[model samples]
Target: MKPESDGGSEIKNYLVDKREKSSSRWTRVNKTFTIYDIRLKISGLLEGSDYQFRVTAVNTAGNSQPSEASQYAYCREPTYTPAPPSIPRVIDSTKHSISLQWTRPMYDGGADVVGYVVEVLEEGTEQWYRATQKTLKTNLFVAAGLQSNKKYSFQAAGVNSNGTGEFSEPSVEIEPVEKLSIPDLDLPDDLKKTVCLRAGNTLRLFVNVTGRPAPVLTWRKPGIDLQSRGFIDTTDSYTQLIVEKVHRYDSGKYTIEAENPSDTPGPPGSVRVKDYTKESVVITWDVPSIDGGAPVNNYIIEKREASMKSYKTVTTECRKTLFRISGLEESVHYFFRVLPENIYGIGEPCEIPESVLICEVPSLPQDLHIVDIGKTSAILNWERPLHDGGSRLTGYAH
Candidate 1:
């Protein structure tokens, strides 16, 4: 006898071989004895679950494996599920683009995933557009050529023979940023006058300007009419002047003119030169608060220091910011002042605020003597002097 399950009911079939009419392969004693075990083969199944089965015993000792089992409850081919793909991460941003990278998916459904698909949507846009083509690559990608200051949304999915997998949650929209404009000119405080240098001494100054297309710079020396031959000028797009080897003759007001065709004119800047000394000098001036014209040159360094009575001339032309003095003599006091100079002429001289004195001797003790002597140590004493020949003498040491 053979039995098969149909839905919830069991259907029995009486079977008898031509030569086995009395054998257990046929109906026997109201109980069915199966000569062979019943097996089921399932065709299709979803990934990720177990299939059920059941078995039935037979009266035949040799065929005890049970041919009367519920074949409908048995599993044939098993199915395995794949893990979901990892969420993509945004790692970098630019004015017009964003970069995205992702981890591998934990599950690939039942089949191996072939590629990944990316989609993006602009803010307020109802439709989503494909951002990238299907790719097996697993590196980061830049969503380039995006609109500046615009927001966008993005998502990713896995692709296989079964078609695209479910999409991940959309990432937060990020807007592309616009490029920054150039900075405006803001002169420093305490800049009021032109720089002053002794004969054969050099001075330097600084000026700052910011703008798009870069600002143009022009230099000037006020108060003193600068002969083209007497003045030297060099320039970069940002700075205008390079005063080389300045001298006392170079002392005057210096004007720094900054201009940018892309922007409104910035304030005209100036530095004053004044207070000449044998070795060093000092200068005080005011910086322009507003950008009126263009960027100024760095500094027109002027120096005037000479071992002999006749001084050599050096000029740092096309300067904008603070000015400095160099080539000063040691053991000599100096007074320096800055002035604004430009094509218009030299501006008023800024007074010198401090005095710089270069001394020949290093700081050391002077006029030392032993007051009393011991076996190992000696008591020494000396009187500190107010000044040494109008020179500051720290002390002399042994």
Candidate 2:
């Protein structure tokens, strides 16, 4: 008969197979091999029925050395104790691996435990499988080739000279999942503004787009059905709408087209174009037919000396047209124009040729002087005036 261990340890047979030299079959061993209760006093005796008992046939000749016992003797009081291995707290977890640590068993059946075995089972599963490690490990158990998201349960056992110990209670379940990383988008959130027109002759439109692969930028004019406006063109990073000489016609709405596999619906952004006109000679203007812009808020009438480099604001009012102008030098070739303003910004000035100017004194003598003043008959002379109501000045002596 053999003593079987529930935990995994080698089976120990207490019986020595006893076949007399003539017997064909061996005898079965049982526990009833007691010998009159005095057998406990003997030193080299066993309790198993098939265990051989030595007899001495020393009749006068010194007994030959005792025959070798066929089987090992039963222990007088062999003790059995089980110490399950300690299950450790997990150190860390990653997408594909788990780390575990454990301590040595507390009770090794009164003998030094030889080794430990770890078993694992998927969470919520009953089938437990064995692992290959012979000793307790403190580092990560490199279990690769696993499902993306799953939990596994683990336990450990201790083995000693006597037998294996019971399995430890299941360690807190450990789970692993796939790692995810997102790429940066080509555009930012705050860059949603569609229109940009500066004080100079520049117009820009910006849009936002997102995808794994970056997208290309395209410029367009939404008002035009065809793409042939000659405005849309591409540069290094920007889609340029170059109005080489931006004018009133180029001062309408513009669209920015961003294209990728996902941009089929339509373009996402737009900008309004407006050119600035400051100097009186440059002849700045707005679309006369369409006043879509914030109607000119107020205009500033400016004047500069013919030889001077700087101009000064002469008048400002809510009116668009020039109504009244006074105190201007006569026949001085002075320039006059109207500047328009709006919520977006100031538009180009309406030049003088486009509008009429009222000369302070109607084309009259630019200079008058008294020469050789005299009484009624004294000689009088003066520079001839260009035009003065078509009349000559009557003389006065003063």
Candidate 3:
């Protein structure tokens, strides 16, 4: 017990006593204790007896007045032990290390938890090895010096003044592996086949590849690099190229290449019809963009009526990049496409939409009239022709 004083007197020691509430005489409970010591323990007290305690302070000057008696207090010892910690779990892993985490024990043995311990066991082994040194104050620990491609299991326990608690259930088995490797191109044979897309339409090309270290992909066209043009995009294992409002000039041999020390290029090119007329149409195409690492020998042209699926070769050995297809039906729609050929074989053909109608001559104008007549010259006017024959009208002749 402490005593209050008006003077600034320092305390030197304390004297304590206890007695039954009904008894008038007080009995000393302990020896005089130093000022630094404020606690006292008494034993051999009758279990059913009512008792009270009082204290006095001694200073350098003198002893202070006795303090008021304290209230009745009970004394008991706790015996419950703490439960084991939750199972340790792998939070993260690398080729050489793994991070483990766990929750605290349910009970701390009626005392504050001092620390935690972690243990690891290799697959197929009965021995468990300590993975932590000097106990861990945090719930997280990193286990290092692990071999790659090897499996491991782990567990954790809580420590208190009572000693280390029971170990938690072992974690699920896990294996560590290296995740880096060289690039492997995964271009399908169907993708290597040439494809024809309509003009003024959107063109989308997708290339898929796989690699351990992740390969760098690039798209290249004849005389142009798509990466420099900022037209290429990557998503996971796929590289894509999208062209909005594609035109004849957009037609070309496009090659997708994957590289990471080693490089692989796709095969083939595409073509399209630039313009059409009733009697003749101009077709333009690109060489095999990838060329299969060989020079394109020439191009082949095929034509068929829009109603037919079979195509007939118009020019099988054409060497020019452009061709004029003539002798077509005036009012009929025709499908025109071009194929690139190398020493190996012919590649996929690029085709245009079947809606391209051939142009034809317009019918004669109606309602011919002479607006004004003169001696030397006369002015004439007439209604325009009903059909322009799929071609834009420039003018009319007398």
What's the ranking of the predictions by lDDT, best on top?
Answer: 3, 1, 2
- TM-score to true structure, per model: 0.28, 0.29, 0.31
10 residues in a row with least lDDT, candidate 2:
263-272
Model 2 residue pairs with clashes: 365-385
lDDT of each: 0.51, 0.47, 0.74
lDDT of 1: 0.51
Off by over 4 Å in 2: 1-65, 69-81, 133-142, 177-398
On the 0 to 100 scale, the lDDT of residue 41 in model 1 is 34
Residue 52 CA error for candidate 1 (Å)?
Answer: 25
Clashes per model (N, Cα, C within 3 A): 133, 1, 2
* Residue 138 error, candidate 3, Å: 0.9
* Model 1: worst 10 consecutive residues (lDDT sum): 13-22
